[model samples]
Target: MAFGLVRIALECDKEEENKGVRVLLEELVWRTYCNGKKSGFATRRECEPKE
Candidate 1:
């Protein structure tokens, strides 16, 4: 679940800095459960964020 959320946030905007990744990860988790089922693994392709 953490991986899925992080992947989506990373895909939203590329963040190389450690802090950026941290912030995005945190936000991902919050927005997800906060909104109820906002985050999830719908498909295999959805799990991978383009580089």
Candidate 2:
């Protein structure tokens, strides 16, 4: 992900990767991210849920 995007995502307390998926769903809408992707390095699976 781009540095700017990462910054924005982190500021929103969003998890970078799969976990970010949930945050996007809660904070942003479908258009917030890719058509079917999340934010962060490693695949979406890299970042797991807190609990």
Per-model TM-score, in order, reads 0.15, 0.17
Predicted structure 2: lDDT: 0.39
In lDDT terms, how accurate is model 1? Answer: 0.37
Model 2 C-alpha lDDT per residue in residues 1-51, reported as the tens digit of each score: 535332222224456785435634354322223433555432233355874
| Model 2: residues with Cα > 4 Å off, grouped in runs | 1-11, 18-20, 23-25, 28-51
Total clashing residue pairs per candidate? Answer: 0, 0
> Which regions of candidate 1 are displaced past 4 Å?
1-10, 18-20, 28-51
> Which ten residues in a row are the worst by lDDT in model 1?
26-35
- In the range 1-51, model 1's lDDT, one tens digit per residue, is 344432232133345776444544433322222234356432222355664
